[model samples]
Target: MKKHSKIIIFILVLSYLLSGTAFSADIPDDSNVEIVSDEVSAERYARCYDERNYEREFAPGQVFITLKSTTPIVEDYGVLFSEVDVDYVKVISEKFIVIHLVEKTRDSVIDAIDELKDSEYVKFAEPNYRVYSGEAVVPNDEDYNLMNTWHLQITEADEAWNYSTGSSDVTVGVIDSGVSPVADLVANIDYERGINFLDETEPPIDIYNHGTPVAGIIGAVGNNGIGISGVCWNATIVPLKIYDTTNREYYVTGIVEGLIAATAMNLDIVNISYSSLTGDGMLEAIQNYNGLVVVSAGNNNTDLNYNTFYPAALSDECDNMIVVGGSTPYDYRYDLTEQGSNYGDCEVHLFAPGAWIYTTCADGSYRFMTGTSFAAPMVTGAAALVLSYHPDYTTAQVKEAILNSVDQVNALTDLCITGGRLNVKNALLYTPISCGDLNYDWRISNVDVIALARYLENVLELTEHQLSMADMNGDSVVDNTDLDLLAMMVV
Candidate 1:
């Protein structure tokens, strides 16, 4: 195995050295990357895609309102709506209430909010934000997409779908080798506003076929009989064709451009399934973007604590970014199938199944890929589903929902900070966070164990969510056994 690795590395180095394109040892930016071609393949016409963020949609005549704490919760908003001369929709959650006015205009929502602001019943109000895909439900395309999609079962995404299939309101940008409008993926993509940084004359179609699978994993129109459903069944998939050199150049310009465009679009989430060294252009663009960004920790088996892969390394600087490493179907941090997934305490944040993973193909079929590239989209999809449940959640909260809910495993114990693999159902549970986070800090550690001990002794108070989290054994009671489990986790 070592000889094979040395031979492979030697070959790669020789090829690059001969081509005069060997990556610099000084930094990992793609300035010196060698180009292959800019021509795009005519695999098929277009299919899936929607420009949601481009033409931001709002629910007409509907306003989302949160009542003051002092006011009583109105189960029946009939009287209140009658008084305000508006119709009541349904209670979204304790965070927000939806009400539809007779007048159907963006102005009506503003006017309604203005009128209700004075009412003691109203604490704050805004338009019921809508876009291409906001509704959530379980999908029927599970059988078709699940043929080789064991990663979903590994992370419990199939169960999480019961909570939210995904929302069209959310837009996730796939800035990789571009995407193809394949039959399975065509139904969920938004083609109206795609950006091809490599070529302007042609659409951002897949010539290398990397982003198609990533996009399919995130939002491939659930229940459309598209063969596979994405993590976000209804969310819009915007193809941000920044770099089509997944197999060739490890460039940074296209990635930088994609980040800029995503920031301008105010995209909800983005998936960058590549790895490069940290540089100014990448850091500046990442820091500037307010939305959540999920990036792949390179497929190399090196520890990122010392090497520091770009966007994955940037996770320390940007709380909104999630650095995903590849795991196996059995949740091993290193997949022997290819170069093992990268890891680090400070860089690679978490692991998802990436070994021999089956997903949508560029030619509108399904294929298997093994790398952090494929794994990153699983995290991106999980993040999208969390946002679909609560669009109001901050990037920090959404990030915690995914990170804190990881399933602790021995293989990942020393590989990454989380020391666990993705658990989609656990992540979707509660408001989100902490395998045993009794203190409700969105993290599980000694502090939580201490809090749990105190709670057992009747010395601390915990919220309903915290109590649920404290039930480490799922026996419906927070006992010393649960406390013991929490303490073991901290250690």
Candidate 2:
């Protein structure tokens, strides 16, 4: 048959097989079929078509070993193994089988399954949908703008005088398709430390142009009258490419290895613009690493009610990962913004701008791409600034401050997990608890009375070396006056 004829026949057969009430009926008891966990069972997982509103909890994904069998080649079976998004499929042995399904919509998967059900030739169909890239999107510009966008005007003097100007001395790891050392934009940092987890070669080469753009957003060289300015002009970017230039094959181990290598370099932040539908345990180990893991929530347009995807927006196992979802250039509600992003009851925190963005590309070019992949680095830039201002803060404290200081408009508040977009200004304004500013921050407690007694008695002067932190009253000197306020706190 001609190629077009074959495709038409395939479609017709699929339609005929799937159009009937096969799924509508109760699964046959004599069918000898078994229902597996939602993660392993692809049929139960529905795609999130609506991006504007998200669905609640359904089922959490899992990893398991299952029996596999070769599907006999027969026209009777409505299904035929095809490759579009599929890399390859093979049978491990007679009793064990593995097949890589084509990457398509939930509708395609369901259609394939419906066709498979009536076929006596094939035993079963299980999904391996867990493959992912560690990426996510932020909200739109309007959503982020509502949070008040603060632009830093860094003059030559500012760059020289500012201790940590625009993420200087910080290394933001770009773990994506290798970065092109576009000398003009990035200054071509060190490539020796980077590893090609996806292709296993020198990591910094930009074969696909994805990583370079991401790098530009985080730390593009600025102020040389360049094409565009990066969020962090002075920060040193560590390019850790995790994707292949040709035929992007996302591997979990590559991300794990990248995280391990980046952490070993003591990187301040690792930006992952990739995500998968399946969880990789190695990623959890990577998350436990010392550096921060910032991931893209994805552009899949499905509710992340459960941890269905891996890495970025979904890998709940990776403890320290900040899963970022997208918002548009403006906070307009639309279906495209709805799906592929995930949320948790309390965990999925922080949102940034992701839609309709233009940025620099590899080879000194510029392009506009859409996805959660781009959204993450903006926050990564904010993080660099936070570290620049407050070098004493820990990773956990930084995460809290970032989440707490977001722009909380109704559009983002309802859609985003943290209920706001990142605010660089508020984050900069946030102050750690004063050692002894009890009047401004006195939590009513019994200890306040004891501390107050000492203050009044003169036995414990608030300004004394040990009691200086207890100065609730302003006055540069901590004295009995502050203790009176502490006593009031107890009462």
Candidate 3:
């Protein structure tokens, strides 16, 4: 009898473990549960689609359900609606599940969802929403000459190159249609590390021919003597394809997924050239990202403050976000080409050359494209250069450097917050200085004189900015002569 009792106790314990403690309590009867209308679920689904203005049809006979985090795996969840003819599709995440109802039972999808919501194991249920990309227009200019890359000179990229041509340690995530490994980008982009979310495990090819040029503008090979130089010649590009060609539009879900993936890779900078009126998911993901995000203020030719666009409007909340507007080669804020650029004192932060911008295109060739899409990459490249120089700089610091170093333009006074155009030269040369403080102790004393003497004697290496500070005579050269002056001043 004693042996039989022990055996029974062990069997009960094993059953509890295997059944996920199912024996602890009985499954609740959902028949008495309140039934909620499908409208609640549809509203949540519509928000994900951003289809408030347009009439959209929900995926027929499909629904998405999320299980509570604490809920343990159970095979019965799949067949919860088996009697109703609904079938479990697959699991999207640990807590999210997809389900499909047969065509004959299409009207029963909502009823199945209501039943699932009433279950104790389910967290919530909603319909699978469809999303599409915003419209991107690029005007063609046939007079494409090598001199079409005048925007680079206007932004002082040529001069900034002397300080830093970007570092291999810096990676810029280009989330767009897709980026092809053109000849000019072969050496600059990290093709092996890139991803195509549109089609899992496939190379991100530029079918729409938009991402390649953007990538070229950001990090095409420099001094190759074959094509125009990119802003950051050495920065690595991580192409993330999110657009779906089948729909001919970018989906909000895809954009959010791309942003999350880029954040996971811990990229130094992310460039988003597309603009939409709704993208709360994208905004949320960006706010949580640790790196800087450069976005385009749409080419809609309107003030974004009143006609707000997302990602650009997200700047109001995300400190790491930089919203770029278009500027003309003549440095005019409201020129013919820039008239279509969106602006707002609080929304749009800075301007860069966007008209007649020359960059690498698909098929291993170069072309002239015009849009705010082309301008955002310039800032992306500049931010990459700054990070290449100071990898330890935080996102906020990099943003401040870019915004504060702009060359103030009067025409941009009421249009943009900075009221100026991007100046990579100024950003590269920005250094907080303290005169007569060679040791950076924030004090001028005999210790500074000794430090200056050591630096001049080549016994100690000083940074370029530090060396400039040691040049107390302001001759732009640090030598023993300056050491003498420092000693006299200290005495």
**Candidate 1 segments whose C-alpha is farther than 4 A from its true place:** 1-147, 244-250, 432-491
**Over 4 Å off in model 3, which ranges?**
1-146, 334-339, 432-491
lDDT of 1 by residue, 1-491 (tens): 12353245335433433463011112223333222223332111011111122123577778888877766666687466554657556777765678877788877876776678777678777677653331223456644533355667657787777666788888888888788988777766777767888776778888687889888888776677547677777788889887645455547988999999999988888899988765557888987888899999998889988886777777765657888899865556754654788898667778988776667888877766778998899999998888887776667678887887898878788887788888877776545434575443355555666566666667667766567767766677777666655555554
List lDDT for all candidates, in order: 0.71, 0.52, 0.71
lDDT of 3 at 241: 90
Model 2 misplaced stretches (Cα beyond 4 Å):
1-164, 198-203, 312-319, 332-347, 432-491
Better of 2 and 3 by TM-score: 3
Output the better candidate (1/2) by lDDT: 1
Cα shift from native, residue 444, model 2 (Å): 13
Residue 74 local lDDT, model 1: 62
Per residue, candidate 3 scores C-alpha lDDT tens digits across 1-491 of 13353245335433433564101222233343222222222322221122221212357677777888877776655555454455556777778877776653334655666667667667887766554332211112332222555666667776677656788899899999888878778888787778888787788888888999999889887776567778888898998898887888887787787789988999889999999979877878998788999998988899987997888878866767898998766555534544588888878889987766778898887776778888899899889887776675667557766887888877788888888889887776554223455543323566666566555546566666567667756667777656655554443
